[model samples]
Target: MYSSIYGGIIRHKFPLYKPNVNLEQLFGKHILFLFSFLTHENLNRAIRGGALESTRDVTIANREHLSDYLKVRDEYLYELDVHLDRFLSSASKAKISSPFSRSALRSILIQLTAASKCKKGTLRYWPSAGPGDFLLSSTGCPTSAFYAVVIDQELSQCKEGVKVITSSIPMKPPLFATAKNVNYLPNVLSVMEAEEKGASSSIWVDEEGYIAEGPNVNVAFITQDKELVMPPFDNILHGCTAKRLLELASKLVDQGLLKGVATKKLTVEEAKAAAEMMYVGSTLPLLPIIVWDDQPIGNGRVGELTMLLSDLLWDDMVAGPDTQRIPVPYAE
Candidate 1:
């Protein structure tokens, strides 16, 4: 973990992550599940305290922070510039000031990845409003702070298909939805709804009945006409991976594998009728959706074109052009 408040990367004597046998046992027995009620006369005053130290951040009280989490593969940061650009744009939208310059932050992330020796995982960073008084306005906050962390994990292309449901939770309004902010309560509820119904995740349909996106990933569809279509970015987060997939899909069009590529508004009726469906995002890159709302999506199996597109993305992530992947300066 790297914290601007700490002035650099925080060293750990042990591995950054480890499976805890105790936590496993506790969760297995559902011991942490709570069902209790307590009455306190000072309950109203309980919300009047705030922390002024960076160690205890105001992130819980303030919902205006911005972030970017990107994949690190083979000691390289994938799509570094694209993700940084989006991160900065999001910061501008949220009015959060970055403690470091963009170039400095990029350098710090690369250094952090190299230091962690994490070859296959994610690098997530954030620029928060910093510690401040508990108030709706951020006027009490001092300078903003930045933090980044690297996780070590296994990475592989997603081949199997998953099911999805139409989210009953209301999607965020266009103002908040367009920018990547930390306010994700509705997204969390939408996914929980899907899980309760035995689905992998859920998709958001706008107030107008147009296909919006998945909980955290962008949705793409392949029409029976062999066209690759994605919902426009007007009311959704402009996904860096999704945009790159669009650029790469052009190759399919050129080779006659796909009829065309487009970004347009898609209705639920039009979307559910598609020959293939997939979710596009940073990690999964591409996840095939074989079923939606219990109905078989085009024969109830992973679409061939969907995997082909996944291969395109996977190959690019592993061995794409130099512009898309940056080699980390790991110490020899």
Candidate 2:
């Protein structure tokens, strides 16, 4: 459970996401669920957190698959489900307004995949609608409603390398940094701010000079010893994509590809001298950061490990262990 700086508290689980806060300020009816599906190529990776609810659109492979990775997630989400409403308070946001539950997000992915009719681009489980702010309304729907749109698959073409810049942007403490919240102003601005500076994205930092995370993704790298290093999960978020990347990377240890995997406090200075660097997250799995503030990171190109790790994750999405791949029951 993470608390928003706006006196809001977010609870996570499939089909049941509730935010508790003062609706008196911002009408109780303007909110949406904060969840999205992560797909590889065109297949869904049924990775969830906090609450895992049942859906009629898709079927779990079996108890074994659930026990493999989702077992812990289920237990965690169940506890959140039972006490969802209990979080209601003045310090929390005041609504749950998504058109579909977390389960529906999964179900749609199944329905799409079962049709064998995917466009071969990419499919995302973003909310069909999202809440809007005071900045811009009047386009078509509620500034506070959720809408999902299909887009051309955006695979990074920066095979040579991509340039990244560090930002001095102060961050808003996420309501639940772990839970995916629909409110992402600070996140968006960081990126826009980065683009204005001719950089692709921004790396946010705290007042203490410690590296926090990327605008919308988690930061990770390799050390001289070949350790897959990520920052501590305290200030940053626990991303579903990042988790899967680590899981796949763990497998490479035995193959003598990676020395080990770990999470530690990473500073910018330490990062500049790393063996390799990449931004890990959903939608865009692992993107290599070749340059930070004009300094070349590792060999200044996408690392060999980065591609292998990406393939492992992509392969897992297409060919799952039955548990990882849910049979999306489509209506024939």
Candidate 3:
């Protein structure tokens, strides 16, 4: 994990307690508070909400922040520029000022990825209002802060289909939904509702009865007429992967594999009648949805074109141009 407060990277294990041996040599006795908070008793208290008033706990406890996720492959960060752009845009919308410049942030992310030696995993980062007193507003924060961590994960193309149900949880307002902030209660509740109903995840429908998005991913469909259609992004999050899919899926149109590619409103009835359905997100890239609300989608099997689109996206992530993939500078 890299913290602007730490001013550098600190190696730690799953529980995020251990500081690197060099910290003692570098900071001497000054960094003792960091270790004190990492102790089992202190962590337990924080987890139990007994220490919610602590300044270091405010960023997460208060839930005033923004975050973004990126896929890392072969020590290469995929679509680094695109993800950074979205992150900065979200920060602007959330009124969170970044402590570092864009170039410096990019360099930090690359260097952190390299330091972790994680060939294939995820890079998750957050910009917060910074540690401050327990208050609803961020006025008490001295300055905004940034933190990022490299997670070791094994992600692959999701070929098999999964089931989903329409979410009953209230969807976030367009203002909040369009921004990738730390407010995800509705998303979590929707996913939980899906699990309770024996489905992988849930979809959110707008108040106007149009498909908004999935719990945390964007939804797309292959229409009966073979058109690749997704809900317009005006009211939902403008997903980077979904946008890329739209761009890459155009190849299918050129090759006569799909009729056309477009983004427009999709009602539940129209979406359910589609020949194929899928969820698009940074991690999933493309996940086929074969069933919704216990009813079969199309032939109740993964669509051939769905796999084709997934392969296109997977290939792009694995071997896309330099513009989309940034090579990480791992230590030799």
Candidate 4:
């Protein structure tokens, strides 16, 4: 049961979304059930504020006008499933070395598409939680529609003991970084930018110039003095993989392995001066970022602290007790 404040009143309820069965069998069931669960979850969360019930009603009414929201959500799910199956099947037969194979990327796309259908809003995922990796555009699909996809290792490369992970191809807006339903453009561009800049990868900046994230990963750094640094949550995407790393960091702090973990607003300049840098996501557990914008980060190489955290994160991801569970409502 998840609980939060709404209208200054405490609201508690079981999660609206939950997977009834393994997500691998998503296409075998009715997609509307999934959308309804997501819708209920978001609404309940919004209602926590207590004054937004009327607004919620209005939003639902407006959503109906945009088209059959449920149908659209189903379509998105179907498309995502199709893509995932294709990617995964192909990957199973291919010799892919990327952290996340094309199949993983497709799975994330499905999740994002489903979430967007419920909110009628748009969402973007960076390659490594830096800036722009591969973005999905669903803003034009419906007035009350949202689309998002995760950027992972399907677009990365390595060289000279440094692994450079780029986003997509052709770095530009509308076709690249601009928010939309399609994501391939930015994914391609971010990777190209990394290659051209001679950096391991490119970090994306939001409208305010704050380090938003990476193409398909989340950014984190360790200061020269060995302090863990990350951006505040307000402007960055909420990365599940990153969240896991933070949890691990908390445990490390408890065990006295790390000095501490800090989540604050950090500028690019501050990050560049940090002793070590890395990116985190579902696919790439932890990847060192030795350079940014052609400027050598820290020692112009992966930092020891960065590697330590990476190892810890990787160990947990591969064998941690935490099992992936879908929210209720989406659950069978």
Candidate 5:
């Protein structure tokens, strides 16, 4: 339950409001679960609709309680000053180590739904690391860019497929690579190096030259015999799109269209020898890789299995069942 101000989050003090602190009351036969919303949308919603009903009137009208709350808030802000002071003097990078977040995208989607209804199409926040229960507060310099990909236009559509390079720097420790981290200084450099060498993307190779995954996506390869092989997830950031694509391929396995699915350490030679190679992530659900460095993989075009998986993924996203989506709860 600690808030990290290392990323310039605390300009003054943070409004670290205290929820119910009673042990017995909180842990009685009836358990009390709480969620905190620290976004502007949430605050506005509370005012427009209604929120914290039980404490709403009291918080606004009670002079003593209001004074005390304001005092505590100011005190918290002062503490932020102290922390910022020490942090600035410290040399090493500061990370806000907290609990591993669950359902982060889920919460964002809910807010996104609300945003859509309000016609407030933009929301901004600085990324932070910690276990979060919905309440988030952070920002960075307002930055925008004209992001464009310099795809190898010829190789992109080449049924023979695109070229990929092996990464010189291996992935970080298991946990660091397993979750999304904001530290992209090294990753950007690595991607640039790969692109400069004429590769569509890069495969992160371990010290022993075993392929872990990719810098931005999870890597997979299909054998000539029609087996889908993925790097072990224990050392890589799990990709949602990859998992869904694999799930959709289960029908293929049942119909004998595919052989099997496996997660194991794959060496560079093994991957290069694969019948087809692909990268899967949220953005590029399934992209093919035909050439690995100087060698050609299989027939050098996107594999049939890759195309099949891509079609299935696109279908699910574009026209999936209503049960798959959460409807926006727009105010009446």
Candidate 6:
């Protein structure tokens, strides 16, 4: 498994410590702590009751295991209400309103759960201002968004071999790209567009005409000279999965397993001429683009770099955090 560093320190380098044997007791304590934290009044009461003073001494003993402590802290943060209506109203006024349907939210959450190796579930949809903004602003929630839409045939042919899945209706960008709050729309639309074009999915273009990413995934390409390249973050959503792949790419470059991948504002012509192209995201980890806008990408087939990156990404997913343990089921 690939290693990660936070704050310049390798995560794995930290010594591991097993949790207390009495899991129930530990969990109870966690709940109590969370309750106190969530209710400031209660915390003040606890402080007066000597609870805070006693805990301060105990906290020092667990400082080394701060990561685990932070995990528990995050759980409490998630428990806080998101005040969705307030956010929605604010987003609407800002012209960043979303057209997310309940079905779309359910489908996306299910897909993410599966992709992230979590349980089957649905997530709450919140309106976002644009691609750069996090879909879910609440702390400890899925930061990404989902879109499901239909792409024009012309755009679908940009990538060869990838099929698009079209809906009976011309799926609007709200279900796919252009919406700030929902993220899954792009993935669904990319797939729809690809199936519609007799390909697998649609290839996305940034404002500069360079390949930004696929609907729900990020794009990576190897130039004719075998230089690996990924799109800069300016034009696309900062995909968590994509971030991880980039991290892996850095490692691969160090080992000479692959050329150093660079992010830049690439033009459409530059992307189309690349020797290889692939899509990366939560669900479709790495899908090679054999064609672009009816033109053959590379040799009109999946390239070797695409496969290598896909394999590397899969390994990381298996070793990553367990997203399912949080259990964000559909709201009743």
Q: Tens digit of lDDT per residue, candidate 1, span 1-332?
A: 67675567744232222334243243233222111112122342111111112433556566557767889998889999999998888888888888889899999989888877667888887788876776766787886777777766567889899999999999998877877777889999999999999999999999999999988789999999999999999989999999999999999999999999999999999999999999999989899999999988888899999999999999998899999999998878
lDDT of 4 by residue, 136-237 (tens): 332322222211221111222122234453333433332222121224446557867777756556666655545667765578888776778787755444
lDDT of 4 at 150: 17
Query: What overall lDDT goes with each candidate model?
Result: 0.81, 0.51, 0.83, 0.44, 0.48, 0.43
Error in Å for residue 121 of model 6? 8.7
Model 4 residue runs over 4 Å out of place are 1-184, 324-332
TM-score for each prediction?
0.87, 0.60, 0.89, 0.46, 0.57, 0.46
* Cα displacement (Å) at residue 261, model 2: 0.2
Tens digits of per-residue lDDT for model 3 on 114-218?
Answer: 877777888888888887776878888888888787766789999999999999899999999999987999999999999999999999999999999997799
Off by over 4 Å in 2: 1-105, 112-116, 119-158, 329-332
Clashing pairs in 1: none
What lDDT tens digits, residue by residue, belong to model 6 across residues 1-332?
Answer: 00010011111111222333342353334221111111112232111110111122112222110000001111111111222232333355334434454454334433332222212211222232222212233232222222211111111112224632222223223222322333344456557666766776666664445556665557778888777788876545555556667777876678776767778778778877888877765445567777766777788777766777777765543343453123334223
Error of 3 at 226 (Å): 0.5
Count of backbone collisions within predicted model 4:
67
**Candidate 2 C-alpha lDDT tens digits along 248-314:** 7888898998999988887789878898888876555578888898888887878888778778766
Clashes of each: 0, 27, 0, 67, 6, 41
State how far residue 268 of model 5 sits from its true place (Å): 1.3
Candidates 2 and 5: which is better by lDDT? 2
Candidate with better TM-score, 2 vs 3: 3
Local error of candidate 1 at 295, Å?
1.2
Cα lDDT for residue 284, model 1?
90
Instruction: Give the number of the best model, judged by TM-score.
Output: 3
Model 1: how far residue 259 lies from native, Å: 0.6
Q: Best candidate, lDDT-wise?
A: 3
In candidate 2, how many Å is residue 10 off? 29
